[model samples]
Target: MKTRKLTAADAEAYWELRLLALQDHPDAFSTSYEDAIKQEDPIGRVKGNLESPDAETYGIFKEGKIAGNATLRYETPVKLRHRADLVGVYLAPEIRGKGYGKMLITKMFQAARGRDGIEKINLAVADTNPAARHVYEQAGFKPFGVEEKALKMGDTYISEIHMTLVLEDDK
Candidate 1:
C-alpha cells in the first residue's frame, strides 16, 4: 500500500472512496451518502479542498486505487491558529485490521508537526466504535469529553468522543 496527500488529479478517486466511506459506514461519518451525492460539483469541491492552503486530504492506495483516506485541516482564526482538526477518517473494511488506520493517523500527525504553529490536533469518533476509539487512544489522544447524541442516523443516535493530542513543547 502507498500513502500520500491527494492532488487535484486524484479527486475522482478520492470522491469515489469518500462516497464508499459514507455508504459503507453510515454511522461512522457525519455526512450521509445521500447528502454527499447531492452536493454541487463534488469533484471540484474535492479538488479545491485538496489544494487549499489550510488543509490537506491524504489517501492510501491499494493496487493503485484509493482504499482509505483522512483529512487534516488547520484552524484559521488567530486565536485558534495553534490547533488543527482531523475529520473524514475512513478505511475500507477489508483493510481495517491491517494497521492502515494507525499509519494514516501517524501521517496526519507528521504533517501537523511540519506546520509552523500547530500545537494540538483534535478529532471526534463515535463512542460506539470501541475499535476506532482504541486506535485513537493508542495513538496518544486523550478523551476531553463526550458530546451526547452527537449524530442522528434515522431513529438511532450515536454519541461522539472528543479527543485531542498536544504536541511536545519545545518552546
Candidate 2:
C-alpha cells in the first residue's frame, strides 16, 4: 500500500470509497451516503477542499485504488486560528488490519504540523472503535471526555469519544 496527499484527481475514487464506508458503517459517520450522492458536484467537493486554505486531505492507495483518506482543517478566525480539526478519516474494511491506519494518522500529524498557529489537533471517535482509539492514544491523543449517546443510529444510541493531541510548544 502507498500513502499520499489527496489531489483533485483523486476525488471520484474518494467519493466512491466514502459511499462504501457510509453504506457499510452507517454508525461510524455522520453523513449519509444517500445525502452525499445527491450532490451535483461530487468531485467538486474534493476540489473545493483546496480552498480550505489551511486544510489538507490525504489518501492511501492499495494496488492503485483509494483505500482510505485522512484530513486536517484549520479554523481561520483570529480567536480560533490556533486550533485544527482532524476529520474525514476512513479506511477500507478489507484493508483494515494492515498498517495503513497508522500510516494515515502519522501523515496527518506531519501535515497538521506544517501550518502556523495549529497548536493542536482535535477529533472525535466512537467509543466502540477500540482499534481507532488505540491508534489515537499511540499518536498522543488524550481523551478529554465522552459525549454519551451522542449518535442516534436507527433504534440504538452510541457514545462519541472526544480527544485531542496537543502540539509541542515550539518555544
RMSD per model, one decimal = 1.8, 2.2
Q: Model 2 residue 107 lDDT?
A: 87
Which lDDT tens digits does candidate 1 get at residues 1-171? 889999999999999999998888888888999999999999999999999999988998899889999999999999999999999998988889889999998888889999999999999999878898998888889999999999999889999999999978311
lDDT, candidate 2, 1-171, per-residue tens:
888887777777888888988897776777877788888887887788844577888889889998998889888889988888888788988888777788899888888778776788899998778888888887789999999998887788879899998888321
**Which prediction has the highest TM-score against the true structure?**
1
**Model 1, global lDDT:** 0.91
Ten-residue region with minimum lDDT total, candidate 1: 162-171
Give the distance in Å from residue 169's predicted Cα in candidate 2 to where it truly belongs: 8.1
lDDT of each: 0.91, 0.83
